[model samples]
Target: MTQQIQQAIAKLEETMRSIGVLDFSGEVQLLEWSKSTSRDGPKIKFMMQDDDSVLPFEVATVKKGKMAGQIYHVFAIRVDDLPIKTNESEIIALEPAAKQPNRLAQAMHTDGYFRNSKLWTGMEIAEAYSQLDHKSYVEKLPCCGTKFAKHIACNGDVVGHHVKTSANSGIRIKPPHWYLVPLCHNHHMTWAHGSHAGSATHEDRHDLLLPHAVALTANQMKVKAKKIMGISSLSEITIELLDAFEEEIFGEAGNKYEDFK
Candidate 1:
C-alpha cells in the first residue's frame, strides 16, 4: 500500500474506534487512475473485510487542495448482519423538490438554526439527540418515526428532520432528497455512526458536519409538513415556522448564543 493509502486506513480505523464499531477491519483496493482526474488526487476504491458480506465502500484520499489531509470522502453502508434490500424506486420517490438549492441556502442562513447559532451545531445536536428523553423526534417523522416508530420511542421536543445526499459509493449523486424523519439523541448517534461514548477521532470529527445536516433536516421537515397540510405555497409556512423555531431556541436572531463555536 502507498503511504497515502496507509494513512487513510489509520484514519478509518480511528473513526471506527471513536464510533465504537469494533472488530471492523478491511483492506484498501486501488482503482485505475484517470487523467481526467487530477494526478495528485488519491485513487478511489472499496474497503472490505474477510467475510465479504458487508457492503464494499469507496474511500478517497484528500489531495492537497480544498480537502487536504482529510479523508476526502467515504461512501459505505453499515453492514447489517440481517438481510436488507435496496429499493431504487422507493429511494427515487423521496427526491427533494427542485427548489432544493434555494431551500438549502435559506436553511443555512436561518440564524438560530445553524450558521450563526451557538446552541446547536453538529456535535451539540448529536449529543442532545442521543439522550433518552429526546426519542419522540425520531419516532414522529414521516420517514424514520413513520417507518420505525415501534422500534424506538421518546418524549423530548421534536427537533427538525434531516436529509442530505447519500455519499456512499453505489448511490453517489443519486437523488438529493429530504428525509422528513424525526431524530433524538440515540438516533443522532446512529446517524453519525458515533453512538459509542468517547471523544471523537480525527475521522469522527470530520464526519461531525452536524450544522449542515441539521439545516437540511429542518428544510426537509418544512417540505414534508407542507405536503401533509396540503398548503398551496410552502414558502410562507416554512419561513414562519423556521423563524418561530429560531426564536424559541436562540431567544432572538441577533442574540447569538454562547455555545455555537
Candidate 2:
C-alpha cells in the first residue's frame, strides 16, 4: 500500500481506540477501496480483528473540508461512543450506515459480508415509493395489473416487498431498497407469500417489477449524473456509467435475480 494510505489507516486506528470502539484491537486491515463515482465519493475500507470475526469500518474523504477547500480524510465522530465490550453484531447494528450498502456493502464484497452493496432498507424504499405517482409506480405492480384489477383493486395499501430474501440473509437485516417493488397487502402477502397457492410467486413479481425498478434507478442516476457532470442530453449518459449505477444497486454480477434466487 502507498505511504499516504498507510498513514490514514494508522490515524483511523488511533481514532477508533481513543473513541472506545469496544475492543478495537488487533491489526487494522485494508479491505478494499471502492472507486469514486458520480453519485458518491471514494470510500476506504478497514477492519480490526475482534475474535472469530472482525469489525469493519468504512470511511470516506470529506467532500468539503475547512482546509482551503481540500478534500481530505478526517475521523468525524459518527456516534458519541460505542458501547464497551459490545458484540460484533451489536456494534454493527449501532452504526446506521452499516445497515446499508452504499459504503458498508461496497466494503463488504471483499470480506464476503455481502455479494451486492446496492441493497436498501425497507424504510428507504418506502420513502422512494412515497415520492412517486401512485398510478404510475404503485398501481402498475403486477398484482395491480388489468388481470388482477377485477379481482382486487389496489386497496391503496401499497407496501415495498423485497424481491430476494437471501439478500438480507435473515429477517433481522433489511433488504436492499433497489430490489424492492410496490405491492398491495393482498399481493404482497396473500398471493406473493403463497397464502393463495398457485398465485403470483415472489419470482413472478420480481420479473414483472424488475424492468420498472431498473427504469426508476436509471432515471435517478441520470438526474444525479446531470447535476454532477453538468450535462443535459439523456444520451450523454454512458452505458458504463449506467452499469456502475446498477452495480450500486444490484451489486456485482452474482447479485442478479437468478443468483439471488
Per-model TM against the reference = 0.22, 0.33
Clashing pairs in 2: 119-176, 120-176, 120-177
Q: Which segments of candidate 2 are over 4 A away from where they belong?
A: 1-151, 237-261
lDDT of each: 0.36, 0.41
Which candidate wins on TM-score? 2
Per-residue lDDT tens digits for candidate 2, residues 118-232, read 3322213434322333234433333332232234444546676655645444666754455455667766666556546556656665565554444343333333333333333
lDDT of 1 by residue, 51-162 (tens): 2113111111223333233222444433223333375311111222243333522333454343222433322343432222222333443222212222444344444433
Which 10 consecutive positions of candidate 1 have the poorest summed lDDT?
A: 51-60
User: Candidate 1: TM-score?
Assistant: 0.22
What is the number of backbone collisions in each predicted candidate, taken in the order shown?
15, 3
lDDT of 1: 0.36
